[model samples]
Target: MNQKAPEVHPSSEWVQRIFDRISGRYDLLNDCLSLGIHRLWKRAAIRALGPVQGKHILDAATGTGDLAIRLAKVGAQVTGVDFSGNMLIRARSRAPASLGVQFVQADVLKLPFKDHHFDSTVVSFGVRNFEDPKRGIEELWRVTRPGGRLVILEFGGWMSFKGFTQWMARSARLLGADPEAYAHLIESSCSFPSGVGFVRRFLENLAEVKTQSSRKIFFGVAHLYVLNK
Candidate 1:
């Protein structure tokens, strides 16, 4: 029997509610589901930023501010934005004031920032949640300064590994995540483009944008894409 698929792009309000609901356990669940490999992937994404010290950077969809906190600790003036107020609360609590990281409640699609305002911008595992990913990417590009890079770390296509989405859903449930929230995550990842497909479909048409590199992480469970403007 064929089963119905989960919604790949849920409403913005739904996205906000799910993230807020899971905000408390979000980081832990990520550790459990990815077996802590996500930490390594994040480190790789940071390295691709290429000397962020003292640079102004934007960490869009910075849930819990993990990447933003890391960037700030490394001397970059970082601003992390997310639409979930609960998530922002946790992010603010987790981030030390001395780190110079600020958490804001804002939408990625409609960032409250001026054009060419950031030295660099990054989105880790957040693009898929955007109702319009291409527009999201364009927004990220809009804020990045000329000659700066846009770094994105996202899941690879799930088709290569049969039953991977099922495993993720089951594991997330076991790890105490809301079932529907994780279902949205699984469905979005399964539907979103990655690596070359992402570059070709979403990024190639952007003016003055150059694909720096696209590499798979951990046997294609995730991918890192770096683009220079």
Candidate 2:
């Protein structure tokens, strides 16, 4: 018999603590885990945004401001929001004043923006961490302008080499990173819905949104989902 997937309802406080604890070495951890290919995945997500020049965009869960800074560099006015204060601190430091990227410390489930305020909204690898991913998506859609797109980049499915990934998580302590935090991340990705399942359960059932496209990257290691409001 097939096993049931684990539920992924991480509390807000727990999520905040995990991210804050890992913030200092968050970028390094990503580079180590994904072998730096995450940069390319992010680039693909940006490309899916299509013609962001002068557009007002919101980058939800803008860890270390990687996607936010890149969007700003390409002429989009970007506001990056995250609940972890430490993560936002690093994000602010990494973003140049010239790029004009604003980093805000806020919860994704309760965004501090006016309705229909952003031309487009994007979240990279952040949705799964939400205590309520469905409500988080609703908040993203609430801030997006009519006809604006909501782009989400996330781990598409389970990583192939479970043993190796577990080992990496264990070894994270050697690099002064929290192994439990990395383990939680790996666990969440394994449980969260991906690809068609994600769309059907999250996007398709939402009356106010339309699923524009869903693209799998790196043989379904990650997915880029585009939705229009």
* C-alpha lDDT of all candidate models, in order: 0.87, 0.87
lDDT of 2 by residue, 1-229 (tens): 4233234877888889889989999999888878899999999989999899999999999989999999999999999999999999999999989998988899999998999999999999999999899999989999999889999999977563588567666657667777567667778877778999998877876657755789899988899999887
TM-score of 1: 0.93
lDDT of 1 by residue, 1-229 (tens): 3233346666677789889989999999888877898899999999999999999999999999999998998999999999999999999999999998977799898999999999999999999898788899999999999999999999998533657766777788778777677767777777788888988887888877765789998888889999999
lDDT of 2 at 74: 93
Candidate 1 ranges with C-alpha deviation above 4 Å: 1-6, 158-160
Count the clashes in each prediction: 0, 0
Model 2 RMSD vs true structure: 4.0
